[model samples]
Target chain A: MKSKCSRENKRKLENKLFKASSLTLTLISFFTVIMIFTILLVQSKPLIMKKPLSEFLTVEWAPHLGKYGLATFMASTLFTTAIAMAISIPPCILTAIYLAEFSTPKVKEYAKSMIDLLAGIPSVVYGLWGVIFIVPIVRDRVAPPISEALGFIPVFSAQNNSGYSVIASGMVLAIMVTPIIVSVSYEVITYVPFEYREASLALGSTKWEAVKKVVLREAAPGIAAAVVLGFCRAFGETMAVLMVAGCVAKTPTSIFDPCYPLTALIANNYGEMLSIPEWVAALSVAGLILMLIVLVFNVVARIVVIRTAGE
Target chain B: MDKRKIEEKIFKYLMISSTAAIIGTLALIIGSVIVKGAAEVSVNTFINDDVALFPGEEHGILHAIIGSLYLAINSTVISFLISFPVAIYSVEYMKKKSLSPALTISIETLMGVPSIVFGMFGLFVFVLVLTRGFTLLAGTLTLALLELPLMERGIEEVVRMVPVSLKEASYALGATTFETIKNIVLKQALPGIVTVSLISFGRGIGEAAPVMLTAGFNPFPPASLLEPAASLPLAVYTYLSAPGQQGKAYASAFTLTIIVLIISLISRYVSKRFTRYVSR
Candidate 1:
């Protein structure tokens, strides 16, 4: 009787210990984002103190002259991501619609597997492919034709026909993010109730009309969320973009011009900038900016996705 | 009516063609890697460690393959250790707590943070402060942190799917909450846990940005966690920049791709088995 009682007491003690330990672990996990934000802010404080924050946003980025302007990098980042979205959204949405509404089970299965394979490929491999295949295509085939046909437009004219240009980065990013957008949109589209589709068809509407008016309308917000997620991924991407973006610290005047992005700025300089503390801090500030942008977009996207999923 | 018919036909064809184009792009990407990598990937590519510097010199990526597997396994293990506990606490303890929303948001935010930003964090915390330099420990810790939220979310989803009846049954038999979790919840969630682990491992193996920031390059095989290591993705990146190393780069990419392919297939197989078991 004594032994049994002691054993019971030990089990109860173990349970209490388990609860406390796990709660502590949970709290730590919960605070990681805040920790990261604080670390970035503290590390970048030195740079922020030496020079005003506004100076960092100026057009020049020559660290030697103490000029830390990031406008050019910011513009390039935005341009490339915008181009990626413009290129990817149309076909991604169409593919999602096909998989959800049209494809038979076997075909759907195969398509999903293919998408997973695409998603599974590393960024470096994509960069390799971009260098070998996409770069030449853009340099020789895509950019020259566009430049010749649309030279009047500032964005289309080629100042330099280097294969590593904004278009190359955008094209690589579009391919990289396609699987994400497609999968998310497919899920959202499939979640629309079958009854909604049945009712639309019963009204004697054609299949495309039913889909256009009803299904697309219902899944619009979710699709927007998916696109935002893709945008965040493309913006945050470092290696693949770094490898192909030509890393020239200039604001690109044309899609065929080489430009630097914020990610590339951080990645390209981290190793060599160690001797200069101020430069290191400046890079930290760049990282802080990147984190803030991604965090805001990610939160918005998550909220939309959660709300749609809940409904 | 005539216009509507034509519109429907046009859109149907458009959707089909767009999907075909997407698939074709994927095929071309994979086909290019395979075609190019085949020439450079041989048995020596796995056994030898020295990358050929000059013509007719012997070369291999054995160190990178070994390093990648080491980092992925160690990081996944570390992540699983922390994530499993947090997941259990959330599902079992914090389900009704007001902190649930905060936890969810934190996890999602962590998930959405770019890998590059994580690289910055890893550089700050591990490379600069703790490890004092690029080491396997720094790389592993950084990756573990990156994988933490992903593993937690995946595990939590699976644990929540565990039927309440089993827990109640355990409690009825006088099992403690901890015991119930260990024997009943975890047992039921094994396949899902494995699947998530595999996915996280694959992510760790394929990730280059964070690893590049934390894991300094080493040409030789790592002898200890304190030593710098080579990884396949980073190796690919480095080799691509070398004048005559493009062949090595393609081969490294091919090996990494094959590793990821195998992992995904295994995870799919595990999940399929899980669903079948549940149905039966």
Candidate 2:
């Protein structure tokens, strides 16, 4: 009776301990989410209520006047991110399709390893390379000719002091986000059943035809979601854009001309956004804008993911 | 033999180029940094400080290196301490299926959060009037905050990969649920959790934003955790951007990159070994 009672007591104590630790972890995870959203909202409130919401729609960012017009920055952020998506998606999808449908096991293994190492490369190193190589090349050679071709626009009509242009930033972002997009798209394509591939081959359709008709069509939503994610990452990115985007606060009418992005603005100024409440107000305002951008992306991404859950 | 073969050849060539592009970029960055930055490595380079306020004298990134490692290790450990328990609770205890999805969403949102936004939160809450000095401790705490979400995500992923069948089998053997998880679930998930931690470790070591504000880039070695000190990332940025120290900055960047690469690689290796051992 004594031994049986002791064993029961041990079981009860163990149960209680396990339950308690599990509860603690679950709470911590929930708390982290609440914390992230709460912080963004709280920090951004100053600009939301006090400042004109339309101020962000303007072309200038004049802090002294309390007008942190994010028109230029928003444009650059969206434009470059859009450009990257455009540049990368076609090739990435093509690569994904080929790998998913056509490539042999040995080749697939080679690509898989390459993709893994690609994801592992850090952003700062990319930033260093960008400044050392990309800026000079764009500024000296590329922009002038592009401007001459599209001479009607006033923005790129005159030569600028630097050529850390919008196109260059876009190019760099495309390169950075390629692996992430390709890998996800590949995963989704391959997840399309072997039956589809076999049916296509048996139907006298070539492998390319099968992938284009069945696999690619099936995985289109997932690919869109992948592109959206890549876009969001490119938009949120700070370090590389900070180094290469020339840190100028101008609006760009031509792709080759540079303008400061929202991320660049926040990164460049936030640490030094001191003394004036207005600067903090502006920080909050920009934060609010960034928050909306991210929220929209997350919602859309969720919708796409849910829509494609089983298909 | 005609158009189709030609198209196939073009497609093959494109795939090859894409693969080369990725492999080439990685090699270029790593190789270039080593070749250029390694040339600037020296004893003084390690010892001297980048005191921009002073004239004609440069200090090595000794203080920053120490500061960074101290903060990164502290923050990583703290984050792991918190996140590992939560991950354990998330997978093992919450076998009640309804609550797990909500937990998963929370984890996903945390990962989606931008680091810049996190910096603002850090500055506003912790750094402002509360922490008077820009110290190593402040940096570590902030880094811990950044690492928390990532660590939880990593651990949770690994824990989930611990099969349900294994859990059932352990219970069938008359082991208590705690014993099953402790011996089987935890053992199985250990590699994955470690992999995630290593990823976070690399990220923390390379972090610049919090350290920019919280650790006020001291040139000399900080006297204690409370004192400000520069880190490798900050030093590289400050040195490279400054007029005369490009070579030193480049070398320091290389050094920091190597440190990050090694930490991540070792953790990954350890995790893999653990996975192999556990499976056996």
| lDDT value, residue B153 of candidate 1 | 99
* Tens-digit lDDT string for candidate 2 (B119-208): 666666666645766777777777888788778878877887777888888989887777887788877877777788788878888877
True contacts kept of 2: 0.28
RMSD of each: 1.6, 3.0
TM-score of chain A of each: 0.97, 0.90
Which parts of model 1 are misplaced by more than 4 Å?
Answer: B51-57, B278-280
Please list the residue runs of candidate 2 whose C-alpha ends up more than 4 Å from where it truly belongs after superposition: A1-11, A148-158, A302-311, B1-5, B51-58, B169-176
DockQ of 1: 0.80
lDDT of candidate 1 over A1-311, digit per residue (tens): 99999999999998889989999999898999998888888888888987888988899888887788989999999999999999999999999999999889999999999998898888888888898898999999998899999989998998778899999999999999999999999989988888999999999998888899999999999999999999999999998999999989889999999989999999888898777877888888888888999989989988988887778
- Over A1-311, each residue of candidate 2 has an lDDT whose tens digit, in order, gives 99999997897689678878768766866887567567666766667677677866888678887777778888888888887778877777777776776778888877776666556555666677677767777777777776787667765563673757777788778877888788878878877888988998899876666777887788888888888778777887776677777777877776777768887787778656767766776776666566657757865775576567566
- lDDT at B257 for candidate 2? 78
Candidate 1 Cα deviation (angstroms), residue B102? 1.3
> What CAPRI grade goes to candidate 2?
acceptable
- Docking tier of model 1: it is high
